[model samples]
Target chain A: MKAFYRWTRDLHLWLGLFLSPFLVVYAVSTILINHNATPGRDAPEETSGPVLVVVPDEEDRIRLGRDIIAQLGITGELGGVRRMPAQQKIVIPVNVPGKRQVVTVDTTTSLATVATKSPGFLSGLVYLHFAPGQHLVGISGNWFWMRLWHWMADATVYVVLFLTASGVYLWTVLKAERKVGLICLGAGAVSFVVLVCGLLF
Target chain B: MARRGLTYWNRKLHIYLGLYFLLFLWLFAVSGLILNNTHWTFVKSKPVDVRSEEPVTTPAATDDFGMAQDVMRQLDISGEIHAVNRPRPKPPHDLFFSVVRAQYFTFVQVNFDEGVANVRVRKWGFWSGFARLHTVASMSTRGQNMFRDWWMTKVWSVCVDALAIGVLAMLCGGIYMWWQIKPKRRVGIVCLSLGCVSCALFVIGLRALFT
Candidate 1:
């Protein structure tokens, strides 16, 4: 029993120490999301002056959109392309963490305009929470960090689960703490059930 | 005496809150993983039970949310209302709102011309439902009047706030507890530093280059 307790304790501590920073990122993002912290005051910088790109002859909207951004000398995850066949124009959305660019292209004249918005670093961290999430699932994140951030996010969650389980075991080993811990555990269980059942039924 | 007592309670709260929040932490955390790993083939299951029901009687409510609820109650359906498509000016134009849940999702499209509500339900898998829990009251979900239309959404929102705050509190308590262990302090410092530096590099480093 002693050996097991010590092992669990060490596992919780060492893993918690490493995982806590990533957990902080999740926590901050959660707070930002729950509070609706997407402040609209900060305007986008459209000053990527005289954007010139070679309009490729590709017929596919996604490929054409990709080719335009490649020639324009900017990078991020490309979003859905809005095509205006009559006007021969396609609007593309590209995003990284701190910045999002809306690249509008004119196929006929090969003219392009880029409007870049820095949603702030805090916002960048918050954006990581829902990157190629459910909306655009089953696809790779278009940018490097967006893809890497999801990997980190996945690790944090798995650790949190392990830490929670180990925490309960460690608490159980302490006879004095058991009573209060049970009360807390019971209270949490009730809250979770009531809240979920309330939503579902 | 009070200061000392407060410190003691803080430790107790940390343990207890961590305990109380254990299941919630697990729920959100696991749900988070499900949502984050949508690239997995098994997780990419499509919505099942796709069928439209016969037209039902419509209701009269002034507000968008209230009207949605009236439509839901009349149809014997219940869930948070989302993806509201209000009376578009085009052919087959009608007011529509989705009744969203973990397993069952129903769409209510009110056709005033025929004076009926078209109910389309697409039952999703458990994975999709679980993932929906994490995003229940998130900014992604649409609401008006602070989710006043859905009592459950309001309740869920409060829980989300409490859980986030509780986690932060537990982290502080854990750090405090770590500080008291003289022997483990050095290694803990190294562990924490590596974690913090790595986090800063990804979050702050990427932004620095773009700026």
Candidate 2:
């Protein structure tokens, strides 16, 4: 029993140390998102010279955009792809954590103009907060880094679940702290119940 | 003596806050996992649909949301008023809006001319209900970034903020306690530095590495 408790403590300490940065990202990003304030929200845009890339016949926008970006060699996740028939162009948005660059291709001339905007550091945190999100339904990430981020984010949460249980165990063993800890736990439970019921019922 | 007292209080606060936020953090973590891997067989949400029509009198309110509230009251539907739209379709329909709770989404489309509101309620099981809790603040659509009108939204948002801040506090306290263990300081520094560098590289270095 003593050995088991020691192992749990070590697991909590080491995992908590190694994953603290990722944990802080989730915490800070949630607060920033709640306030509707992320840094680099108003970063300026820069447009680059047109690069030639053929827009081939394809029904799916993401597939077509992927083909186009594959030719350009710039890496980022693709947002919704739409074509402006009047302008004879297809516009695609490519997004990384800190930057969003729009690729507009002239179906006629085959010239692609890239408009890039950097949303800065905190926006990067916010972007990482919801990368490879639940939306885009059947579509998977085309960018390597975005896909990697999905795993890292999920792994961090898994460790977090483990940490929560271990934390409770560690608290329970500290007899001097038990009274204060239970008080805090009970208060949180009641508040959580009220908030959830208020939202649902 | 003062420093000793400060250290003692810090430890107490850390333990207390950790216990307070134990279940609070657990909900977000579990729901977050469900959302992150939404394609999982058991957690994938398939909302059950029920469609009906409710008779509603034209209320005196002129604004779109006020009229939505009036219609909601008439029909006994409750949840956040996600959106309200009147495209003024040919021959005029009364109002179109959706009310969404954690477990169900009720879409209401009213026809003032006919004195009937066509209602569709799509409900989901707990797996999806918990998933819905993860995104209560993010109903913002393109061209519709209205402030959340529901009090529940405000409370939920504030709680999330508080929980996040508390976690950060506990993080600092945890590190302080580890530092007090003289033998673990070297290893702790290494682990802490690795985390900081890895996150920095992922957040800022990825674009440079890939592009």
Candidate 3:
């Protein structure tokens, strides 16, 4: 039992150390999101640049938007596309590092207007919080660095789960702070249950 | 006074950082579960009652933003006006504005060409309101509103950055402490290797299967 306690303690400590950075991102991002305290709410800077080549007979606005983006020399994953039929324009939102740029293309003239915004620091952090992972098979096309980040995020999840379990064990075994630890653990467990139940039922 | 050994300090750091992280841990765990299972009807939303007035004169064709401002002024819906949507320049293009408060949200849609304004209020239930916080990131007021924007956006962002670094330190210290326990070296390696292998396999398998 003594050896078991010692092993558990070591396990908990190492796992916590390795996984804490990712956990912090999760915790902070969750809080900021919950409070609506995310940054980057300001209007983007708009600039009318060179006209983009009009895709002949391309009715798909997303494709046209992508084409326009390529022409404008913007590099990043396509985040979203908003089509405004009334204005005969397609707005494509591109997610670049620490910034979001919008490309507006006029269907009639095939001219493009680009608007860029440096999403506030919090907003950028939030974006990092939910960045998507690249696929392992079937045309794995995301950037190499982004794929690495996605892999890290995936590994972080399992590591965190392991750490959470080990943390509970550590709390139980450490007699010196068992009472206080139990209280904190109970608070977390009860809050989780109550909140979830309140929402579900 | 006796000097403390490295292990003692390491354990102390671990304990304190763990304790400090408790509240945030709980918040994320619960909110994360909620976010993951959004398909569940855990949060219910309803349209709020809105009072409509006579339609005002249509604003100029090029000034959709100005028209939206006029609509807000007429309806007396005050808060940070967030442009929700600006449709194309065709006739009857509706301009959408959103005002988010602590408890509820006010959405105003105006058809500038038709000179019509429709206001809708969305009252969020407790769970829904709580869940909505996960999606809230706005800087409607930057420098002008220091008290609100500065504290909420800028200050909170700094906290997140610091917490990130602190977490990394905690992780590193934990591994070092574990390494010092030579007797358990074999067991530690086995367990860590198992974890890493399983994680790698799961990630690879998932990507192969899904994507």
Candidate with top DockQ is 2
lDDT of 3 by residue, B74-172 (tens): 776554454446334334646766665434567776675677777777666666556544333333432232223212333333444444455665666
Number of clashing residue pairs, candidate 3: 11
**Candidate 2 on A1-201: residue-level lDDT in tens?**
999998898889888999999989888988877777757867998999699997888998888999998888777888878889998999999988888889999988999999989887788888888776677755547677777888888898889999988989998899988887888999999998888776665
lDDT rank order = 2, 1, 3
Per-candidate DockQ values are 0.62, 0.66, 0.08
Query: After TM-score superposition, what is the CA distance of residue B3 in candidate 2 from its true location, in Å?
Result: 2.3
Tens digits of per-residue lDDT, candidate 3, A14-119, equal 5654454455455555456545565767747657674765644566644665677777777555655667889997787776435667787787787887777766
What tens-digit string does per-residue lDDT give for candidate 1 at B35-74? 7777677766788766665565545777666677777777
Lowest-lDDT window of 10 residues in candidate 3 chain B?
A: B142-151
RMSD of 3: 10.1
Q: Residue A158's C-alpha lDDT in candidate 1? A: 81
- lDDT for each of the candidates? 0.75, 0.83, 0.56
Cα deviation of B192, candidate 1, in Å: 1.4
Worst 10 residues of 1 chain B by lDDT: B139-148
